[model samples]
Target: MSTPKLYAGLKLREIRTNLGLTQKAFAGKLGVSLPYLNQMENNHRPVSAGVVLALAREFRLDVTELSTDDAERIVSDMREALADPVFGPAAPPIADLRLAASNAPALARAFLDLHRAYRRTHERLASLDEALDTKDATLRPSPWEEVRDFFHYCDNYIDAVDRAAEHFASPAGRPGDPMRAAQEALAHQGVTFTRADGPWLRYFDPDTKQLTLSSRAPGSTQRFQALHQVALLAQNELLEATLDLARFQTAEARAIAKIGLANYFAGAALMPYRLFMAAAQETRHDLERLADRFGASIEQVAHRLSTLQRPGAKGIPFFFVRVDQAGTITKRHSATRLQFARFGGACPLWNVHRAFETPGRFLRQLAETPDGVRYLCLAREVSKPAGSFRAPVRRYSIGLGCEVQHAGALVYADDLDLTRSFEPIGISCRICERPDCHQRSVPPLERRLSVDPGKRGILPYEIGG
Candidate 1:
């Protein structure tokens, strides 16, 4: 099969604009004529191999960004947004959606923002308490959702924070015990670190300059908490700068995003990028092996693997999600084309749900989405014990997977037939185009359905063509 032609006009324009280069200068640097560069920028012509090479050599660009296809993410989000019952059954065709995503991404984002605002307004009016609260009546995206979208659009990678965490882990430019490094970093700042048996995992008293970590928590959690504090104390300016770039509308969103960046810093410091990526490649991404090598938990290892989206040196494009027992997607990030549902729970057919049934073992699945993308998915159940028998345990299942093309690099993909049948899965029932799924909870909004009182198959109504 021939490769698809690349038409990344927006990304090309963005790169040139960021460098403050005019069409002529950018064309000269890219070893292309002004007319040819203009044609490529307008997407009249596909970007050539020569231009890709020139981008790498002249601009030191990550060539992969040219064909990154953020349009896919936009398209998925639009589909989900249109699935709202308020939109009715006559939504725009998928082709038109793709065109809007590719040619007019900003407009598409604006439409999504409008739809999100409408939904929030509708929800607020439906609730009695929020509707009656007349003092503050701002209709905006939830702080958590805003932060999630920020990370989602960023491909779950923050370059500056990631590099800062790496430098903190290796002050002398060499990998060492990240925990010890964090402890010493805190000590240097005249902060006292102590472990005490209590409910709070990690708490810093600003007045006393004392950091208390729960003794009952596992060593990995304690280490991660320490790094998290390091991020806030040592990398405050960087975090604040990054938040400024985000320019969130609400103070709540900014505060939540600060915490998120700190968490990202902790994860990055715990598993330094280059070192962790090398270890992952060497170990074929065995979560247990990675956890042992990095002094991290399996869930942390899985999440860190998804964030290895460094510009020049990127790891496999993987998708990571953590779901509670009830199947709600608590945490999600995808570096691949498979974007998760922005609302509601995960697909029931996916193996991540079965993870809760079998604790302490990895469940492997060869699954295909409705769009024909196949993946080698791995999931395992993780239980966080809260120190005492009276305390409730936090149980969540984490899923990690990459496209089938990169499945060979995963140890979990061994002994599986990569060319054969794959179990079908969808993002969500409301937006999924698959009509014959038995596990579907609701009819697809874009398809017509016929109901008959006398007949019933897997569903009460038959979907129309």
Candidate 2:
């Protein structure tokens, strides 16, 4: 029987085009020659295990995707091509062809790249199809959700580092600078740092066994780099261990979880849990002074402050949230048992939205829900790191809040008038049954609308009035 031809070549070409990358550029990125890339795309090669692993690591791709059935089919096709008897005496033996496919480094790399591209395309198409089939297509996870989850689970831990910094800053002789200690810790782990010129100046070279730290300065972002290094070393094992425990079904899910756990560990490592909690209690959760002492961003300080809710050693009871200019909640962590609406839209009149208009300036407000539960909020715009001038994204505005009675503890409420009536807002339109709210993007799924012209309300038309 004739061997069934695999369209691996076509898939490779399609992915290259989809990413708008030239054959040469793709080859360079993969650390392979153009001819080798072309040969793999043409089904003149078979993938090997090492190259498959390399593709997964380099592209942050799923390993299962790189070792698909399509790759097996391509291998079958190559075998059939070698057995054809047309070339006669000058033709290489089938054994020779098999050896070349198996041993040739370039051919192995090409096959791996082709397989990886195919897997990525296949998964993307499947996600789109699933999105199309769902009712209330808009109900599907938004880009904001993905971004927020990425940060949350990926364990981006500036919180932990800042906590560590604060912990060591006591009267019993400071343990050098927290940043210097972090740097020293990284060096102890055999990770060397060097200044480089690039958008991603910091990259780990597994081959050279070096973690190069970039010198790109966003004003006071140097301390962040130091903390990040500490995260790489101190939190690496913990992050890996957490991911191992997660046992995610898909490689993609596992990859994301691994990143999240790493960030979490990073935060935990930076802020030794016990010390940070103690400091929070002592200062009543003053973010500015906390940030100053730890050399961390305010957002980092606030996030750590919220995590001090351990069973016995709790600090201030608070909730933390981060939103962009579009009022999208990118990060939400709460110590209180308050229910937060996960999807739909957020309130535009909230202090979080107002903070974006006055970037870098902090704002304070007292918010009260229908249940009469009042809270104090501190909102400020946190600048997003720009990758390049051409693709600039908006800075984020994050809000940190606590119960109204705990307002005196925060610096934001000290100067502001507590009696002023601020706009009342909810987490999202679906959970919030508030009528006449102009910010309502979509009505609640469970709420039935009444359409009487005379009795029509402003926002939600009244559920079965």
Candidate 3:
């Protein structure tokens, strides 16, 4: 097998522009001719080894940024978008999609946005009540989805926010109790803290300067709620600055993102980055042990693990997702090459779907996607009790996994035969290229289908080559 040539024109151009250098000046720094630099920047030619070395030595660049992370993500998203039935049976080839994603990412994002708008409009039109509502008829993207993509494209890592949370968690270069820090911060703001029986987990009265948490909530929940309030009261300006940088299209999205950011701050502060990263490594990425160490829940521990992409001090790239019993993905993030389905449930073959059956036990599976990527997946059911028997209990299955190559770092992979035949999985049925999938909910949009009234195999229709 030959090595794949790197074509990182977009990243090269970005680096150059950020340095405030023209093509000639940048070329001079990289010891390349202006035309040669232009060729590399335009992706007409692969970036040479000398240029990569210059980027590291002269510019102090991470060089790993030149890798195809964003490009791959864009390509995967484009593939999912094009798999829409509206695209008919003639979707563009994967090579073409890769080219567009690599050379013209902005245009690729624009196309994804257009498709998202079309999807929203189609859904609105499908429901008469929704079509009648003027508010629902707008083509504006879903605020939740818009916020999701913001974090998605950022690799679920916000540098400034993460650093600030770390500082709060470890003031004066010494590790401190985040719960205590949050309480002191709230008290300094003249906010009285108390717990009471209420349906809501956390509630704050701005006028009275009173912050209240539910008495019935667990200790971890209470601590998290306190930290979340600290984010709102103490880190308001920082959160706003981050939101401004995000530049969400709608006020709804901006508001939604503020809560998300505050939640992020809470999580980061709860499990301070350096402390958590070191503990994760020492414990071999054991979720239960990490949760016990960090005073966090299993779900919180898993979610925090996925956000360990802090550039210089990164952990193993992992994917985290939470799905309801109905199979709708409620939350998702992937630092790995495995991107989840953007608009639907995950692959049914995945162990996450079966987590509901065996309530507390962790389900493990070695699965392979159609693209030949193998992963060690772990799933367990998480339940959020409403603190009262009469109140509804919310249950979701959370999955955390990394590529098979990283399996040694996970305690859950113990005793599992990595060399065994892996269960096949996919992102979504419409985008899945596996023709013989018995669990396929729908046929792939890109393939031609042959209807055989006389005979059938796994599917009623045969997918064409």
Candidate 4:
């Protein structure tokens, strides 16, 4: 077998910049010529063993982080972006794509941004919002997706906000009853907390000093909403400080992101980082057990698993996804290599889609991505009752999984073969490299197709061999 080439230009450049060293100085320290260092930094050449040692010795850098899957992540993201069909059949060669991903990641991000603008414009034109009024309309990406990407790249964790929440839920602060604690906190500001029979999830009356939660919502949801209100009331300044640092591009994005951050605070506070993490480790991450222990729903527990990236006190990195019956990703966040599709729907072959059929029981899959990474995936359908039969029920399937390397830590992985068999799944059909997939939706954008009417196999057209 051929040796696997190491292309870590982004990480190399980051280390060089962080150390404030010039290319000549860096090369000297690494015992290489300046031209060689430049080539490596641009990913025109692979990072050598000598440079890896030099980095460890000179900067005390973790060599393991240097060998990360940055190239793979970027290549996956770029492939998905280029598969828009607007890019047409004239996609760049794989070598060029890899070069762009490693050497100039910023340009790749810029291209993705430009495409989002086009997609937003296309969506608006199709919707005919205001009937081509063109009033107060400018070319920009969908603010919601923009905000989502902000959190996506942040690994769905904010240290300042997460720490503040841990403090709030600490033993000294967390009261015997979370609802009572919220009432007391709000009462200090002359705000009263109560439940109301209403269509909305949560409502606040500023003039009447009242915070009202929906009576129809589940008890777990009500607790979440109460804590979310507490975040908005008690942690506005800290939230604002974090927002200022993020510097979102648009006001709508800022507003939506503020709510998202508040929601994060609510989940973190309700579960409380240190305690929840301990219970997760002890229970082997049993969703039902954690939910019962923390008075949270299984869905809430699953969602919180994705946000456990609290630096030195981190838990297992998990990817969490929630899909509606129509296969829309209403909520998604990943701290693993398996990022959910940003635009297109997920693969039909994945077990998450089958989750709706198996309600209450968890569905497990040992799946592999095109990048050769495997995961122990778990999915279950969760329902939100409308409090009465007169209204519609809100139903969704939640997916949670970690890398197969950590599968032993999960109760769901017991008796599962992590070595022998695995299901092949991709970010989506558009970018999947699996040529023999019987369920492929579209030929990969990066590959060619061959069609002969007289010949056929699993598919009418044979992908490039």
Candidate 5:
């Protein structure tokens, strides 16, 4: 596969400005002409190896920060935003989109903001006249989506929160049960806890200094809720600080993000990063074994595995996704080149869909994304049983995978050939580039289609160039 070019224009400019260096002086220091430096700074030219070396030597910069992460994120979000039909068939080419994301990152963000506003306004009013008459109509990213993107760009790991959770779980400078620690800490705070069969999962009555946990919930889930409440009660400042840095557009978003951070803390605490990483390595990443060892559910283990991105000590960069029976992506995170569709659902061709048919068993797929990057994907059904049989069962399929090179680390990839027999997969039909997919629910917005009444193939109509 071809490697994507790097563009660190924004980062380079920030570093230069932060160091208070003139463009001419910076160019001289980097052994490049002023015009050449200008081109690189503007992303018209790739930063050269000599320039990279110069930045490291002169500024003590961590060259790894010069990754294409920012540009890639912007490009992915822009692609999804542009897929909206309001943009029509006149959307810019992928090459132009990349240029905009790389060379004018701020403008690209502004465009996304405008699109978010357009959507919010469109949802609020039925007609243009109604829209014009509304006095308080404002545009902002949907709080939930904004938070999702925030975590997405963060590579699904909040270092501070994760470390704090690890610390909380580590009593006496040793790994211990976080749930027990939370209980002990709460007791010291004059808060008493109890378990009961109830309609609510957890209820904390601050006035009475009582926390009620559901007896019906699974042990792992109960533990998670306990830790989540602990995070809210004890770590409010840290959670708020993280959200403040995020600066979400709406209070609802901020509230939702607080819960998300607590969930992160709960998961991290249940499986302390260092101990969990060691166990994962020892077991070849066997989900069941890790879950048993950490006293976490398989789903929790899978989710935590995707968040092993703690800089320098990063694990295999895996993508974790959970889809309900309807194929909607309920939860997702990826640190790899492959990105999931922001709208609609996952590719029907992917094994995640098939996981529902064979419940209670793990399914494996050697799959390739539309970009030709391959992954060794694993999928299994996770079911939540209600207290009584009369209540509904919440069922979802969990998927976890990393690129082929990292397959060796997974126990699931024991006998499979890493290089061949890969199934083709795409993000979603709306953005998928494949023309002959039989399971496509919709034609790609990026391509035109032709209707051939007399001819038929995997697709009912031929795709136009």
Candidate 6:
């Protein structure tokens, strides 16, 4: 029996029909003859890179989706075919194939679409498995995980404004203070700040050529405004450099990684590596003192402190997590090899939730997992920016922690009792098989148990030992 053809000519034809475009009109948009376009849709010709790019740009669709015809097998086949030497011996032929890719676009479109579909499907399956194991499973992998992994491997930290500032201040070592340098950089970009009556107008005229800054908070707010200005001016260069460093083979992956890297650079620029690392070590990772010195919020100082793992010159390895009252984790970053349950919710006993009860007060706790891994947790609540006086403001919490062995290096552990029998918690339900845990939001895998109404336990159900 012959192998089934994975080409997606039919799908291309469907897309053309959906667009309400005639063959001739579609061909014209691709800069190809109608017959050539028809040939591609009929699988008489192969799809190339140029055609894929055109379809992606013109239709505003993901290139992979457009190329793979939304089929995984087709994408796998195409990748295999591209790796074959039988296509040609010379580079010029491949270059030509790329130039006239639109003329034979079906194959390329089919391959990309299939790959994306496969990835999404696999991720969904993983999520389902996690859900069955733990009730508090995540909707997907943490976005911060995706972002941080991209930056750690990628090279080239080129930021345009930073570059311009570096060039501008090459003779003076990029200015003495990072905040002052950032302010000067923004001035060069025609962005200026002025005091405003309300907090809603903190950053104004974002649509205009000249950006404006307005804030109610006197000191730290000004520093944040400068940081944002730097981010705006340097985002593109930082994104491009980081993406290049990541070396993503697919266009889709590159685009996603770019956004994450740009955010990373913005955060880094605001913190300034050298000074931040120095302060973290001196203060023993004290959030309050670091916040005061940098004119940053408590959360900002903690977040920056977590990213201080730059190889040989690293500070204490820390994990930072952010969550709202609803228990949804918004951000997570770790320098150590901390394993988070990919599919379930965090332990309710964790000190992160305690921050909400105390509002602005910081809470510290020692926690250990069944695996014997211990952690030192410091958590505090933070309020979101308010829109208007009548509008209800929202508050969220952030948690910063490190291993128990490294706890002594942090100021949060100074007054806390290290020997206290703190609560034992796990990252997620499926991985944590603690039989007597009253806080188990979901049951562990392969464990059968039922609730006995006559003998009610601390939790809803009793697990068989």
> Model 4 clash pairs?
none
C-alpha positional error of residue 206 in candidate 1 after TM-score superposition, expressed in Å = 1.2
Query: How badly does each model clash, as a count of residue pairs?
Result: 0, 16, 0, 0, 0, 22
Q: Over 4 Å off in model 4, which ranges?
A: 1-9, 12-73, 93-95, 122-138, 171-177, 455-457
- TM per model? 0.94, 0.60, 0.93, 0.87, 0.90, 0.61
Cα lDDT over the full model 2: 0.57
Report the lDDT tens digits of candidate 1 across residue range 137-204.
43567788889999998989999999999888876766799878888989988899999997799999
Worst 10 residues of 6 by lDDT: 68-77
How many clashes does the backbone of model 3 have? Answer: 0
TM-score of candidate 2 against the unseen true structure: 0.60
Candidate 4 lDDT tens digits, 350-459? 88899999889999999988877888999999988888878888899989999888999999988887777789898887778899999998888767899999998999
lDDT score of residue 274 within candidate 5: 88
Clashing residue pairs, backbone N/CA/C < 3 A, model 1: none
Clashing pairs in 3: none
lDDT for each residue of candidate 3 in 1-465, tens digit (9 for 90 to 100): 135578899899999899999999999999999999999988889999999999999988877778786788998999999888898768898878878998888999999998988888887678754554666436678798899999999999899999999999986756678888998999999999999998789999999999989999998899999999999999999999999999998899999999999999999999999999999999999999998988999999999999998876888889999999999999999987789888889999999999999998899999998878899999999999988879889999999999899999999888999999999999999788898989999988778899989997888999887
Q: Each model's C-alpha lDDT?
A: 0.90, 0.57, 0.90, 0.83, 0.86, 0.61
Q: Residue-wise lDDT of candidate 5 within 1-465, one digit each (tens)?
A: 765667788888988998899999989888999999899888898888889899889878777668775677678778888878888977788778878987787899899888878877777665544554655445556678889878987888999999999989974556687778989878877889999988878899989999999999988988999999888988889999999899887889999999999999999989998888989999999999998887899999999999998855778778899999999999998877778887778888889889888998999999998777899999999889889979898999999999888999999999997767799999888888888888888888878889888987887877776
lDDT of 3: 0.90
| Candidate 4 clash figure, as a count | 0
The local distance difference test score of model 5 is 0.86
**Position 119, candidate 1: lDDT:** 80
